[model samples]
Target: MNSAEKIIDRFGGQSALAGLIGKRQSTVGYWAKKGTVPVSWHGKLLEIAKNQAIDLQPVDFIPIDDEKNLLPAESSLPKATHWGELTIGEKEIPCYVLNTGDRVFSLKGVVVGLMGTDGGQLVEYLKVRALQPHLPSDLLPAENGEIPALFKFDTGGEGFTKYAVGIKIERFNELLRAYSSALLDHHLSAHDSTKIALTDRQLQIATTAVRFLQASSDVGLVALVDEATGYQYERAEDALRIKLKLYLEEDMRKWEKTFPDPLWNEFGRLTNWKGSVHHRPKYWGKLVMELIYGYLDADVAKWLKENAPKPIRGQSYHQWLSGQYGLKKLTEHIWMVIGMASACQTMPELRQRMAERYGRTQVQMTLYLPVQH
Candidate 1:
């Protein structure tokens, strides 16, 4: 019996094997006709077969071929020990993008989340048509004993060798962008369903979350921001001041000058205080709240310009702020945004790190002083 015969007999029939792979019997027969399993079904087929406790080998595809191609072979593929994920559409496809000196990876599982019947077809779609070269290279198979011995597709074959995948580090980002773009075209995306109200820094937080997913990096967004901002309140105030210049400078005149003064004053040029001369002694928290709200207004405006749908973007500040989910609510969300950003200065991973290090989930500053009125 031939390799096809062996597979069919082992699994009952071509129809049974095809059923196991969620493919038509004709597709299974085509594999038998070509005397080779298509690469797309390689991972899934192997996975399902293993789950059924069937140990498959490469010779099953090339039963008539000579013995030389059956042995373990060497190939220079990257050493990718770190596992990561690339989320597309709604599914998060697990992958690895590691760089060990010159080599990148052996990609057998990259297509697990893609829309291909095999890895070869998916590679063709990405590299040939999409013009994305950073995708895994079609290197010959690396045996289970090789340096990059991680080839999940090599099971057992009879040709010179099956081709494996390797991606260059330089092209990793490009690969992600292309893969993400393709996913967006094929499936509904988060961007399409949600409003974009995050400021650039806040957007950085989102992107950092995504980047963390991509490489499964050990660090968190808040930690990375802390390294950049030194976890200082003054730095956060300065950054928020820059944000205010973009969207809320004029509305800010409602508060008196020298009330708290400009949060950041880089220039020594004398600009007269232009705030209203209202005569009410105020609580310090009220003044801080006003600045926080103004900053949020600007931050939301910028986020809307880039992420929100057209009608929302066109609304004036009053109209936008007056909506059902207006200032009072936005104030809280925005507070979380800036507060989270500020907290990053001291707590990189924030809640998790805090919980672990200090044995706490919340913190507060309480001043105990006798008040004489």
Candidate 2:
């Protein structure tokens, strides 16, 4: 077997390869990719041979000699050497280190910044927080009263050190639970036992569906942050805004394919087809949620009412959401509106808010605010 494959097999193959390399796994990975070990580690490999119960011979693996066939250049930027103090907005948060290069911080805002320190304090902080059940392995401490500190860690690779912290979305979770439960029961019943009239139930179902759709969009936004900022929520949001815009433009292509001439009458309701027997069915809820989640806030809705084509003035919320508003418009609106709401600032606060705001019903308002600056 090749040297990298041999080292890989020594730890029971690929499944356990990561554990064998310890904190320096990426370094070994780099060497393996290049098909050579640094000249300095050759003797150490031989010494480790006895303890690892593996044969070690210089000839067994290719010598570090060839330059022409070396792997693509990679940064030797030392793994983040320092983790600055845990700062959520303006506050210096209490944090714990989890390993040699993992740390946890607490935050609940959609906007956050990742700062580096001179030593490995971030990872040390994560280790400390991991000892407690309330803290997430990927969360840092935020609000003390509602959120009891959390844990989180960054998975570093691709030439950049990474960090991540999970912000609990209990309101969205409850919405999902309510949705799943309603679907299973085949009825829309609030926990408080309010007798929802038949028409009200239908409206509730549609509204909840739209909210969930928005939540799905929110998930995409978070993922965008993860990719762009690499353990920093602050940069992630900036990148997310850009990514969302691209997603909208792409979605427009899909819309053109799906509905070539989705006609709306003067009232903003689909009225271009005949009766049910010769009907052109419209997807109202899906379209509305996409708009509200993507761009149409209260003010935007008001502006549309004032300036939209006169025929569209009376259209419903769902009708408006599904129209031309895509990622670009939504990003613009989110940047403007996200700061208005004040809600939970940490995970525990999120859970608490969920119970207080939505415990008796299947729906509630959720605000995403950044850590206080």
Top model number, TM-score = 1
Once model 2 is optimally superposed onto the true structure by TM-score, how far is the C-alpha of residue 232 displaced, in angstroms?
6.2
- Cα deviation at 133, candidate 1, in Å, is 13
Which predicted model would earn the best lDDT?
1
Error of model 1, residue 100, in angstroms: 3.9
Q: Candidate 1's error at 344, in angstroms?
A: 42
State every prediction's TM-score relative to the real structure.
0.29, 0.20
Q: Write the per-residue lDDT of candidate 1 for residues 142-231, one digit (tens) a residue.
A: 233232223322322333333334444344444555444433332343445432233333233234323423432222343366568876
lDDT (10s digit) by residue, model 2, range 89-197: 2223223343444433323211112222211223333233112232342333344423232223332223223333322344223333433443433343344353332
Error of 2 at 82 (Å): 23
